[model samples]
Target: MDQNSEVRLEDAGDGAYEIVGTRSGDRLGRVALTGERVTVEVVPAARRRGVATAALREVSRLTLRDRERLELLIPWDNPIALRVALAAGYTREGIRRGTPELLVYSRLASDSGEPAPRLLPDLPGGELSDGVITLRPLGEGDVDFYTELHSVPDVVATSVPAEPKPADEIRRRCSRAATQWLTGSRADLVIVDTATGLPAGEIDLYYQEPPLAQAMIGYSTLPAYRKRGLTTRAAQLLALWVFAETDIVRLVAGALPTNIGSQRVLEKAGFTREAYQRQRLPGPDGGRLDDVQYVLLAGDLLAQASGAGTSHA
Candidate 1:
């Protein structure tokens, strides 16, 4: 539990777990356990300081010590609660079909107290470098370069979906990239040329559902930065990191049938073409597009002659 001496969970009788500050004796929050569900409420004054995460973890420990499972059903719009729930090591099962507004999460005695295996964990310092190309978490600062890349013909043909995203929408996506990393939804990273220290491209790891041991990757290189093998290097670095740092055993990517250049990039990175999936991706004009899937297994990556590289951050 966090904030140990700063705050403590006091059992004020009648099943009420009051979170009180040790210093000022102020009521910070409360953890209520009803049936199999666990709920936490934090006062506005004491928010965002790890109090809620600590309380929820303590409650889960106390409950799981006796039973097998602990549960949390936070509202769909409550991002703060969701963060706390995740920090406290809850697994997001799914949203209830009958109650779509609620996002369901649960903790079990058998579950390791780490972040859910399905959620992508943040990289330390959010960077990876091989002394040449550097990969760092994409941020709002990359909006200009990100928008520029989307304008390239090859990028548009290969990565852009049927309907192009508007400028405002692209900016919004760039802004939310970091938050997505924190939430473990995705890892959006900008590829930087080490010599020039300029944003050269972008890559992302999209977490697949269910068997959390699988993930997919996507990439786009700026027109000015292509033909230098940076995309291939980024893919290799990311695959190495995933295999070394995460349980994801299979990393995959896809490209259009005609995008032989992209296919070759994946090939150079040691990803094997697995299938010619017909109409696997959404297309423009309400149709579907075929994709050639490429895959790299964990054993394949781990057995490679190289390493996950280093972080220059």
Candidate 2:
């Protein structure tokens, strides 16, 4: 159908629709409304050509006529559908907890003039330690220390994709960590050796938006701290912190199978190997490496705490 063709909507019964291309007399897509929620699906060829957008506008118009609100539930992974909804004047309201990320969008019929509240809640703060090691949030004063930690060869090899950067890039990353925390996207902590109170490494827990009770964790240790089990202790403490403070039910970690040291650290922290993906990660030198995935459930932590007769659970 030509772009200027007159698109028409026909009743397909029971709040269903058929968007037809007038010029070529072809069915472009479908739109359905059930209990104030509108969902649109366009043919592969008709996508991005304003088909979904046109249908969504019609839906909104109908909702307004009925003195009701317009809503759409779009998956986080489906950016195309989200774009169409936003283009049609729908504001993201919140997330409906389901698999991964199910974003809910709404626009009140009485007031569509302003944007909805879009920022996530700020993360809670605290310190976690196990006498030998501690895990704490990174601060402005930690930029230099974080930079030096990334400069360590062993640390760079395992975490970052490229060679170690100077202080400026590290500063940017540390600053981004602040933003991520404020937006509830991640929780980044500095691993400390309590004996000397020096930074031994760092650990990260990613994925903070709702409908996602699982987070992925990553860690790096400095050369000087290798073989000392400080990272292991820090990870264990982090697990405790995450479970106690947040609603996260599962924590995951990935390590290069060849990196026995990291595997050992996860194991010591009560994580169990779950999957082995062949050539799943890109190597630093443009090669592929196998990824060994590990996971720790909330129940696992509780069981461990009970076994040790500790009050962490």
Candidate 3:
């Protein structure tokens, strides 16, 4: 079958075009041109193929010839869509908050007319595992567990505000976590008990830039899962992922001096104490709190691997 002939575009008026696959007689999707932004969508059935990419290429060729900039807003949770955009040569520029959330990707009309250099890395797939615990990407199924995690008094007091959060807000954060992976801005991993396959906690890494050469790490464990060495194991796996998967130079974390638990977790994860800042963070009690900083470097991980006489495999 001639795929090119099967895929057709129709002017939908108002600067919009309808994409249809003639062979299937399915309205695959639509594209809308508004100012410098170009939005494209493919029917669910046609997704993950070359449909969207082909449509985007045609759009770029015809519509973007005289355009200096073309932008695509992809929901952070929509990794498939982000992949399509990336394949069609879009560079993630920044993040924005809204319903469903979004990462802004754009391409510039350059003198050479070539695609932009890929600024975002492919989303981490599969799972990172240590001997005792495994860390995987958070998903919608984790909403209830995540909510329960935040509801713990100690967790609320140390991580988020002391006040109760609406259910909607918790859900929004869960969705954002899924999208953060695609945006290359953050990776929130659900720490699972390897023996039971249940969520024990979560760990997060937030990148500072597209280079993703440095990041800040954070974590929380469920009340029932604490003190079993789960969080420490999870942190180690995350540190290993950062050092092995990306170009990260260092991973950093901060804790209130009063939160001895977090400090110990960082230490156990091989993060060296970096600094102590006075009144660095706001406390729940409306007072300033001292912050203790910790860091783990790629070199440190390598040294540890060498000391153990094992490859960092």
**Candidate 2 positional error at 63, Å:** 23
User: In candidate 3, what are the lDDT values of residues 77-128, reduced to their tens digit?
Assistant: 6777777776677777887787756788887765233443332344366887
Candidate scoring better on TM-score of 2 and 3:
3
Comparing 1 and 3 on TM-score, the stronger one: 3
Candidate 2, 1-313: lDDT as tens digits: 2355466677898988898887777999888888888889888988778878877776676667776687888764465676677667777678799665577877777755332332323334457777878787776678878887887777777764636776766765675565455435677888888899998888887874457688888988778887887887777777776777677788899998778978888887789999999988777879877899999987887787778553211
From the highest TM-score down, the ranking of the candidates is 3, 1, 2
Q: What does candidate 1's lDDT look like per residue over 133-212, in tens digits?
A: 99998877877888887877767766647555679878877876765664566888999999999999999998764265
Error of 3 at 266 (Å): 1.6
Question: Which 10 residues in a row give candidate 1 its minimum summed lDDT?
Answer: 304-313
Instruction: Score candidate 3 by lDDT.
Output: 0.77
Q: Which candidate is the best by lDDT?
A: 1
Candidate number that wins on lDDT, 1 or 3: 1
State residue 63's C-alpha deviation in candidate 1, in Å. 8.3
TM-score of 1: 0.73
- TM agreement with the true structure for every prediction: 0.73, 0.59, 0.83
Count of clashes in candidate 1: 0
